[model samples]
Target: MGNSLSDGLTDAVRRFQWFYTCHVRVPHELVEHSALSLTEMRVLFAVMHGGACTAADISRTLGLDTGYLSRMLTQFERSGLIERRPCSGDARSTQVSLTAAGETGLSAASAHVRDDVSTTLDAMTPGERAQLIASMGYVQRLLSPPADAPQVRLRGPRPGDFGWIVEREAQLAPGGTHTQRERETRTAMVVADYLTAPDPLRNGCWIAEQDGVSVGASLLVDGSAGSARLAALFVEPGVRRSSIARRLIKACVAFATESGYGRVVCATDLNPVSVAPFLRPFGFEELSNQGEWEKHLKEPRAF
Candidate 1:
């Protein structure tokens, strides 16, 4: 019986490994480019996304070894793909920005990768595609970066952001996830409403980044002079733990307080599985037990 149990456990481990390889890992071999290596592609992506960055910052963002990054930097510099300049505040530090050639190369490569992924995804049935995407989403949330991970941020929602926010809300609602067509049209209308709103605080949203990718979002919705509600707080699965949710929460609270709201409130449909722990540390109390949980933020707390 012991031998049989051991065999069963071993088989389970092997299957798990196989599943991880098949579903979770992107095959880097498929990303082959004649002009750029994989490391170069990653560096270029980081520089392009951040607008301006330094070698040290790039290493931190990608969690890459500095030695390896230096080599890549040298190659990119030689190719005239990036320019390095002295950091304004620090003479010893250098800042890197993309050259026009670098930008064009990165864009072309991005388009190629997207086309390849789309082609492959197109081969699946709609239901199969949905399941694959949902499963990946679940894994993404599970593997989200830790709270103290480096974050990149922008101040608030820009002109085309309402649509992005709507799409985010729909994606996060599980069963209520919207289709691409629904996302495009309905999100456009939602954006229009936000755009027309008189108050800046009423129609604003923030996206949190980890490893140079947008991982989660929070929104400040209409409220009276000194109060606002935190709405549509959602984080992508793989990057959930990295304190992005907390940062987003704090952003909403700060926005409320600065915009003349004395306090901010948040409501969560309590799921023992996913909702409670993140709130407890931020002065969130067990306001009710009827399957809904609420928290009010009156002051900032160190996260």
Candidate 2:
């Protein structure tokens, strides 16, 4: 029994090592092919990703030592790969953009990196690919710094959840309003209408479950055959800080993408107090206010 236990622990460690190394070996391969120093390649990649970013932003994203990043920036300038200009918003900050030469060189470096990484991944069988994804998800959860619970599953609604959702309308409304109770009633009716619609694609709602309880919810309504709008989103009180709202929005985006909609939109009566921060991270941009917000959803993999 003791030998069996030891073997199991060894297997776990091996799986972890595999998970941590996924897609990470490509960078080292690219450094060799790009004929650029590792630091130079890293800075170039950062500029490529951020699109007119600053040294400080890159430093923060990569967790590089600030002085070292400064040296790298100077070297890149000397190499004519990047240019920095004074930031319009802040005099103390400098904005950086890539030159045409830099973009072409980085594109070549990226192609080499992708080829190397694909070769490594292709060695695995289909079963291995599935297992690797599962194991990586485990590692993500394990290494993620503790926070409010995250939502990872999406499923059909249950029988009693509708009433609980109705109750939520009252709880989510702002304080100090003569019309607070009336607004809650109206909101509940709108939600019920959405839930009872015959077609799931036409009108659907998802509840975000965290730690075995629903913390947030969203409703999606078909604007046309090809487009849908995210109607309502709310997170339970006290759980807002954990990023539950973002997870809920992600679920809606995933659903819309899988359901074959061209795009998804969200409208709120005034900008939703809880959703702006969440939606922004998922590439949802504000198109117009119009006494409500309009945000477009892209594919889930984009997140």
Q: Say which candidate scores most in lDDT.
A: 2
lDDT of 2 by residue, 53-122 (tens): 9888899878899899998888888888899999997999999889898898888878866776688789
**What do the candidate models score in CA lDDT, each in turn?**
0.65, 0.70
Q: On a 0 to 100 scale, what is the lDDT of residue 61 in model 2?
A: 74
**Taking the tens digit of each residue's C-alpha lDDT, what string does model 1 give over 52-82?**
7888989998899989898888888998999
**Candidate 1 TM-score versus the reference:** 0.44
lDDT score of residue 53 within candidate 2: 91
